[model samples]
Target: MRMVWKTMRLRHVGMAFFWACSMLTFRSSILLTGEANTPELESIVVIVSFVANMTTLLALAAWAENDPERIDRLPLWPMAAVVVVGLVLVHFAGRVGGGALLPFLLGGAVLTGVGYGAFWGSWADCYGRMHPARTSFYVPVAFLLTAALFLAVSLLAENLSVPAIVLMVPLPVISLVCLVHCRAEVPDGRAVPEGGSKRSLLAVGSLIGLIVASLVLSCLFGFMWELTVFTVGSVNEAHLAPLVANLMVAVALVGLVLYARTRVNLDIAYRIVVPVIVVLFAVLPFFWETNPVALNIIMSASYGVFDVVIWSLVAATSYDFAVSGFVVGGIVRSLSVLLRLIGIGIGFLVTLVPGKPSALIVGVSLGALYVLVMLGLFNWLRHKRKAGAEKLEEGAQTDAFAQLDTSAPDEISETPGEEDAAPAAGAKSTDNTMPAASAKPTASAERADLDDEQALYTTIAEDYGLTRREAEVLPFLARGRSAKVIAEALFVSESTIRTHTRRILEKTDLHSKQQLIDLIENYE
Candidate 1:
C-alpha cells in the first residue's frame, strides 16, 4: 500500500484533474449544470462535444497504430495548450452575445472534446508504464479523489456562478504538469512493446465477451438519463442523479479497497452489477409516478459502480499485455461512449412505446441483462474447467522436473570448477536412455549448465540486493516466464509476483523485465 502511494501519487493528481476538467467543462449534469443558461444550446454543445471526443479518440488510436513510437515523440505541452484554449472558449460561451454564441460554443466543444481525447491517450501511455497490480489501487483512488474534488469545485461554482470558469482554466495545465512529473518518475519507450498490434488485438478479443454486457449496462444508464432529464421537474433534482451516482461510485471504491486488503475470494463488484441493475429497474416502474427521482438514484449508482469496474479492467489489460495503451483505451472507451449514445437513442425511442413506457424500458433492460448474466456464467464455468486442466498439466511437469537427479557424477555440483570437470573414472550416469559411457559426461554437462545458470542468478540477486521473495522470482524472470507463470510456480498471487518484479527492476536500476533478462543473459 505504501509502495502504491510512493509510485502513483502524481498519477492520482493528474487523473483527478483530467476527470474534473471533463465535469467542469462539458458534462452538463455536474458543475456546469444550468450555468450555460441556454439549456437547449447546452444539450447540443454536450452532444457534439461527446461526438467530437469519440472521434478524436478513434483518430488517436489510428495514429498510434500507424506508429506506436510516435506516442513518445509527441509533446505534452501542445495538448495542454489546446485544452486551455478550448476551455477558455467553453467557459466564455455562456457570457457571449447572440451571433457569436453558437460559433463559440461549437468551437469550444470541439476543442474540449478533442483535448479530452488526447488526454485519455496520454493517460493510456502513462498507465502502460505502471504494473496492473498497482494500477488497481491507483485508478480507483484517482477517481475517488476526482469525485471529491468535483464536489468541492461544484460547490464553489454554485456560489460564484459565472466566474467559476476561472477555476477550471488552470486544471488542464496543472494536470499536464503532474503527468509530466509522472512520466519523469517512470521509464519511457517501454509502453509500445514488440508486436504491439497483435497483442492489442489479442487483449481486445479476450474481453469481447464483455462488450454486449457493457453495452446493455450503458444503454440502461442512458435510459435512466433520458427519464431523469425529461420527467424530473426540478433542474437541481435532475442533476442530483449524477451526483448521487458519483457518490455511489465512491462507496463502491471503498468496497474495492476492502476487497484488495482482505484478499476476498468473491468477485465483489462486477458479478453483482447485473443483479443490482435488475432489482433497481424492476422497482423503477413502481416508483415512476410517485418518485421518479428514485430511478435517477438507482441507474446513476449502477453506472458509477460499473464505471470503476471498466476502468480497472482497462488498466489491468493494458498492463498485462504491455501493448499500446492509446489503442486499447481508445478502442474500448470510444465504443463505450458510442454505446451510451445508442442507449440514449433507445431512451428516446421508448417514449413511443404504447401504454407504460417505463415498464417497456425496464422489461427490455432486464431481458438484455439476463442474457448477459447467463453468458457470463457460461464463460466462467468454461474458464474454471480449463484452469483445472492446466493445473493438472502443471503438476505433471513439476513432478517430471522433481524426478531429475541434480547431482552430477564425481560430486560435480560442489563447485563451478568441479561441475565443469569430467566425471571420475567408471562413474555411472543417472540416465537410463543412453549408453553409460557417453551418458555420464553428457548428464554431467547438462547439470553443470543448470547449476551455472542458478549460480548466475544468485550473484545477480545478491548484487541487486533483491529480497528473499524477489530472489525467488528472479530465476523464473530470467528464463522468460511471465508474471502469471512465476506466480503459479511460487504459489503466490499474480499481483504479488508483479510487485516483486517491480522491486527487482527498481533495485537493479533497469527499465523492464526484458532488461533484467538481458542482464542475466549477458553476464560474464
Candidate 2:
C-alpha cells in the first residue's frame, strides 16, 4: 500500500510536469502570432467563435451525459468530420476578404464553434466519467504544456511552420486517443437500472445558475484576452517577448504546482480560485498606464492562474452534474458557454463606447462582477451539498444501515428457525459479530472509517483494474505532470514513467489522459 501510494504521487507529479512543458510551448507560439490586431474586431470575432464552440461543446456534454458508453465506443472520425468542415470554412475566409465576407465569416464562426464545441463538451464529459480528480490536475498541466509548446514553436516558427503545426495537432489528438483507450473503463449506466420516475429534462434552477456562472467566467476570460492584446501590442519589442513568455510560463507553472500540492475538495477550490481571480482583475487597472511590459506580464500570469482554476473546477463539476442529470449536463454546459459569449459581447459593446475605461477599470468592474457571480454559485453549490447530505442521511436512516444488518446471517437465523438452524445460527452470529465486536473502541472506529475509505479507493482502482503502479500513475496523468517530474518522484527514469503510462492505458482500457480523468470523475 505504501509503495502504491508513493507511485501514485510520483505519477501525479510527472503528469503535471509534462503538461506544463507542453502548454508553455503552445501558448508562446500563440503569443508570437500576435492574433489581437484590432481589439474590437478580435473581441467580436472571439465572442462569436466561442459562442459557436460553447454551443457544440454543450451538445457534446449532453451526449456524454445521456450516452457516455456510446461516446466511448464511437470512433473520432465523425467528430473529425465537423472539425474538417470548420477548417474548410476558415480556408475560404482566408480567400474572400471584403464586405462581402461578413456572411461567410459568420458561417465560418458557427462551424468553428460547433466543431470545437462538440469536441470540448465531449472531452469534459469523458474526463468526468473516467478520471474526475485527474481532470483538475491535468487541466493545469495541459495549460503548462501548451505554454511550453507555444514558446518552443514561437522560437522556431520562422523556420518550422509546418512542423510546429503538426506537433501542435498531435497533443490534442493524443489526448483524444487516450480517451478512446479508456472507453471500456467508463461506467455503463445501463448496468444499473434506472429507478426514478420520468421527470423534466432540465434542472431549471441549477441550469440557470450554471449558465450565469459560465457567462461571468467567460466574460472574465474575454476581457483578460483583450487586455493581453492591448498590452502586448502597446509594448516595445525589447521588453515584450520575454515579459509575455515569462508571464505565460509563470502562470502555468504556478497553477500546476499549486494544484498538485493542494488536496482541497474540488468545491472548496472552486470557491477559493474564483474570488482570487476577481480580486486580481479588479486591481488590473492600477497598472494599465505603467510599463506595458510589466503590467501585461503580471495580469497574464494572474489570468493564467485563474483560467487553470476555473477550467479545472468546471471540468470536475460538469462531470458530476452529467452523472446526476445526463442530457441536462450537456445543455447546461452549452448554455454556460452561450452566457460567456453574451458577456463577451457586452464587454465588446462597452469597449466600443467612447472613452473606453483603462484596463484597470475594466478589470475592477469585471472583478466585482466575478465576485458577485461566485457568491451566487457558492450559494447554489452550498444548497446542493446540503440537499445531498440530507438525502444521504435519510438513506442511511431508512435503508443502508438496515441492509447492512440484514446481511448478517446470524441476525436472520436467530429470529425463528428449525433445530438444524441452531448450530448454523450460533456459527453465523460468531462470524458476523467477531470483527465488529473486536473493533469497538473510538480509535478502532476511526481506523475502520479510514479502512472504508481505502476500500472505496481500492474498489475504484479495481474497476479500472490498474496495477498498483498504474494506479499510482493515473493521478499523475491527470495532474499533467511531466515525465521527468514523475520519474524523479518515483525514483525511476522518464522512460519508465512512459512505460507505466502505456501499460496503465492498456489496463484501464483508456486511450488518453483526458479519458482516464473523465472516468475517475464520473465513476469514482
Candidate 3:
C-alpha cells in the first residue's frame, strides 16, 4: 500500500493542473464564460471549440503515425502561450463589447480547444509508456489534486476574478514543464511499438469497448447537466459542487483500488455500477424539481468515476496494443467530447418540450441507460464463455493424464531396464530381482521435487508483494516463455503480458527478466 504512494511524482501534478484548466474552459468561469444575449451564441462558440478539439486530436494522431519523430519536437510551449492569450482576449472582449464581440470569443474558444487537444494527447503518450500499477496509483491522486485546484479557482472567481485568471494563465506552461520531466524519466530502452497491424485484436476490441462506455456515460452526464442546478442549498453553495463531486470520485477510485488491489478488474466494477446508475436515473425525474442539488451531486459523482476508468483504460490499451498514445487518446477522447455535445443538444430539446418536460427527460435518460446496461451484459457474457472454454480444455488434459497412469503398469514390465533408468518419469521397475517398495520412492521423490519448485515460486511472489496478475506472469517468464507465447497460453493480449511482466519486474526491484529467473533458481 505504501509503495503505491511512492510512485507519485511531478507528472501526476502536471496531469491534474492541465485537466483542471481544460475543464474550466467548458464551465461557468469569469475568464472564459463570455456574456451573450442568446443561448445560440454561447452554444455556437462551444460547438466550434469542441469541433476544433476533435480536429486537433485527429491531426495529431495522423502526424504521429506518419512521422513519429516529430511528436517529441512539437511546439507545445507556443501552443500554451497562445491558449492564455486567447482566454485573455475573450475576457476583455466580453467586458467591452458584450455580445458584439462574437468573433473574438469564438476565436479564443478554438485556440483553447486546440491547445487542450495537444496537451492531453501528449499526456496520453506518456501514460502509455508507463506500468499500469503505477498508473492506477497516480490517477486517483491526480483527480484529487485537480479537484482541489478547481475548488480554489471557483472560490476566487466571485471576489478576485483577476487574480483567479492570473493564476490559471500559467497552468498550461507549468503543466508542460512537468510533462517534459516525465518524458525524460522514461527509459530509452522501452521501444515504441511498430506497425498498427501487429497490435492485438483483443486489445483493439477492449479499446473500442472502453471508448463506447465512456461516450455513453459522458452523454448521459451532459443530458443531466441541462436539467440540474449546481446549488446545494443556497446559490452560493454552487461553487462547492466541483469540490464535492471530485471528492466522491476520489473515494470511488480509492475503493476500487482497495477492492481489486493488483488485478483491478474493471469488468466487475462495470457490472456493479450499472444497476445502481440505472436506478439513480430512474428516480431523477421525480426529484428534478424537489431537490435539484442532490441530482447534481449524484450525476457528477457517477460521471467522475467513469471519467477516471475511461482515462486509465485508454492509457492501458495504448501500451498493450503498442499503438501511439496520441493516436489512441485523440480518437477516443475526441469522440467522447462530440457525443457529449450531442447529448447536450438532446437535453436542450427536452427542455423545450411544451408540457411535462420532466417526463420526456426521464424517457431519454432511461433510453441511454439501457444502451449502457446492454454493453456491460455483452462484455460479461463474452468473458464467461472464454473462461468456460479454458476450463473444458483443462479437464480434457487431466483425463488424458489419468488414462496414461492406468496403462503405465502394463507397459512397465515389458521394458524394465529402461523404466528403471528413467526414475524421474515416475515409472515402476517391474524387475523380478527388485522389490516393489524400491520403485515407490522414485515416484514420491519426483512429486516432492515438483512441490518444492512450486513452493519456491509462491514464496518469492509473496516476498515481493506482486499483484495477482504479475504473480501469474512470473512462472511463465522464469520458464523463458516469450510474451506472445504466454499471451496465447493465458488467453490475453501480448501487450497485457508485457504490462504484467513490467509490473513484476518493478515490484521485485529487478532490472531484467533474466534477473527474475536467476532469483527464482537460487531460492532455497
Q: State every prediction's TM-score relative to the real structure.
A: 0.73, 0.59, 0.77
Candidate 1 C-alpha error for residue 245, in Å: 4.7
lDDT comparing candidate 3 with the true structure: 0.67
Query: What are the runs in model 1 whose C-alpha is more than 4 Å off?
Result: 6-8, 29-39, 160-162, 233-236, 262-268, 351-356, 384-524
Q: How would you encode candidate 1's per-residue C-alpha lDDT over 126-233 as one tens digit per residue?
A: 765565545566666777776776666676767656456667777788889888877665543244346767888987776676655677777776666665665653
Query: Over all chains combined, what TM-score does candidate 2 have?
Result: 0.59
Give lDDT tens digits, candidate 3, residues 184-298: 7553312243555345334546666566667776787666665442223222243356457777678667776766566365545654675577567777777666766566577
How does each model score on lDDT?
0.67, 0.49, 0.67
Task: Write model 2 residue lDDT over 171-284, tens digit each, in one string.
Answer: 444544554543334433121113211221423344454345444655555454454545454212322364355546546455544545432244444445555655665665
Residue 140 alpha-carbon offset, candidate 2, angstroms: 2.8
The candidates, ranked best first by TM-score, are 3, 1, 2
RMSD, each candidate, Å?
8.8, 11.4, 6.5
Candidate 3 versus the native: TM-score? Answer: 0.77
Which ranges of candidate 2 are over 4 A from the true structure?
Answer: 1-41, 62-67, 73-75, 88-96, 99-104, 158-178, 182-215, 227-267, 291-303, 310-336, 359-524
